[model samples]
Target: MLPRRFNLHRPDRIEDAVALLAEHGDDASPYAGGTELLIAMKARVLSYAHIVDLKGIAALRGVSARSDGGLIIGALTTHHELANHSLVLERLPAYALLSANVANIRVRAAGTLGGNLCFAEPHADPPAMLCALNAELVLAGPGGERRMLLAEFILGELSTARATGEVLVRIEVPGLPAGTRAGYRAFGHLERPAVGVAAVALPLGKGFDWRLRVGSICGRPTALAGLEKAMRGLPEADALAVLAEGAEQAAAAVEADDDIRGSAEYKRHLVGVLARRAARAALGMEALAA
Candidate 1:
């Protein structure tokens, strides 16, 4: 149960929400779907005097196509909606797959993409996948609306660039070229294998271009840009070697922790393995068609 003394503020408009946040500052926490926030509150990890629920605001829901052939997902759209949306499945299958695998059916039903990102859990899935797809985050606050890359938005573990009154409005994923295919993979614990080392990969242009993001095992999901760079213009054998090298480099860069789930060394190894598997799956799909 949540703390009894706290107040709940349900604003009908985004402006009102911002005003409340600006006025109350740290005392007020913006509530999206509340899957993580509520749980944290119950666990006493988060304590706030007032809750600004964003669900009643109509602006924070739905999935729509952008003019640039990408997608604009509202902050409050539930994981269930994203996983099953026709447009999402057709165009951004990587995201759809990631959404489906976030947790069990009930958690997916209750969790919102915005809430997941806002929580910024080190083991979260969406952030890394968004980074792989080169997604951007839109924010609204007292200073006015602005956009930032996903990498920039997630500054560190359990942290973001959102200021005192800023709220994430939506996430925008730009279009990919034709002949692109994407996939997501994860290795969970024995009892919950689905939540462990998660990886997403995208292959484009008849396999000429590729990208992959690995999450859920480190402090944050990391984009394999170095791997993508090394694989550019290389043949299959050379590309695989480059990918492995890049994975090693990325693993080296990660600052993981020794948690109940696994040791830091194990998590780093998981990242490398998942990265290779995801990349291979994406590239293998391309090979089968050719």
Candidate 2:
């Protein structure tokens, strides 16, 4: 299969890129590493009259720490770059670990985090971790730039909140407050995850407060609210024993579909298992109980 014929536009400026997209409307698409968009084009699932390349834009590349101790990652940053970046490793090790596990070597080399988020593939890894880690997305358009939470950016399966003529400029992961740790765990039979869970734990007096997310099994990364509330301030043994059943019930609450991946029920069950394991991993307990 081959992509339909299209004009390729190399825009050195973000303003020019936005102008091209605005002019071409639905017929134009932004091109980054092309790790996700090119595949859809090749498969004939998506088509475009113009492919606007953003790689030449100087502002869309690099990683730097914020004055507030958070990190700002450019939209063009590749998975491999983040996996080994010293700043990411030192401040957000869990994010670095997640980056290292994205697809295989070749895809990681060419894929951009902005593309991954804009593609909105449910089985993709970054969104889950980003949601759990409380990351914010920066978007730019003709009207100018605005910031939004990752949760608001991801609307549904294969969809995002990005408006036409807009580009994802960067992503900002806030520094976790002291005593908080994040971890990610996932399960799938194939290259992408079928069920993935991310946990950010803030251990306080006695039990712990957690931000837990279940991805892949749902249309979007969703918080396991019931299970999370139940596990609050509880120790490992108490959290597991008390909330194990709650996890299953919480899994039932996610929006799942029965496609080539697996049955809805099967994926729902996996969410519970992965959530428990991921929470335990975040808490530095045995990953999976005996």
Candidate 3:
């Protein structure tokens, strides 16, 4: 099957791209990487009369350092590029590992981070890890720019907070505090994940600060607030104990969906298992229990 005929507009500047989308309104969509958009169009799930190509916009590419020791990643960056970037490897190796393992080589080579987030696929990977890292997003539009946390940006499955004319410009990640460690783990039968978990641990006085996020099975990446609170400010041994005891309850509390991926109950079980493994991995231990 083929997509319906549509006009392609290649815009070399952000302003031009924004104007094209704003003018076309619901008839247009910003195109980058095309890993998701092209597939949907071919399947007849979505149609756009005007496709605004953003690859010509030079400003929407590359990786740079933040003065605060974090990273500023261009929205158009490919998964493969991010997986191998020196700064990304040095500052957020867990995220790099996740990127390197996203889908397969072909997707990694062509899929853009911006496109993945904008597509808001429930079984995607980056959103969970980025949420754990407390990443912020910048969206450009005719009215100017809007900034929001990645968690807030994703409203539901295949939906985001982006207005019709907005373009995701760059993603900003805050510097992890000293003694912080992060890890990610996922389980899936094929190219997409069924369940994915991300954990972050930071030393706080005599205890530790913990952040845990579960994705893929849910409509949006979900933070395990109850579990985090139970483990926060506890000694390493105590925290691990709390995690072991509370992981299942926390996973069960999440709002999940039953689809081709797996049943909601089974996906919830994977979340508990992955959460433990991710936590251990973050603390520099083996992911599997002996």
Model 3 lDDT per residue over 1-290, tens place: 78889999999989889999999999999999999999999998999999999999989999999998899999999999999999999998888899999989999999999999999998999999899899999999999988999999999999899998999999999987878888898999877999999998888866778999998887899999999999988987798899999999999999987888889999999999999999988888864211
lDDT by residue for model 1 (48-124), tens:
99899998989988899988789999999888999899989888776787687767888889889988888887667
User: Which regions of candidate 3 deviate over 4 angstroms?
Assistant: 287-290
After TM-score superposition, the amount by which residue 88's alpha carbon in candidate 1 deviates from its true location, in angstroms, is: 0.2
Give candidate 3's error at residue 151 in angstroms: 0.7
Considering every candidate listed, which one attains the maximal TM-score? 3
Question: What TM-score do all the candidates reach, one by one?
Answer: 0.88, 0.94, 0.97
Per-residue lDDT over 56-117 for candidate 2, one digit per residue giving the tens place of the 0 to 100 score:
99899989998878899999999999999999998887788888888999999999999899
RMSD per model, one decimal = 3.3, 2.1, 1.7
lDDT of 1: 0.75
How many clashes in each candidate? 2, 2, 0
lDDT of 3 at 36: 92
Top-scoring candidate (lDDT): 3
Give the candidate order by descending lDDT. 3, 2, 1
Model 2 per-residue lDDT at 163: 92
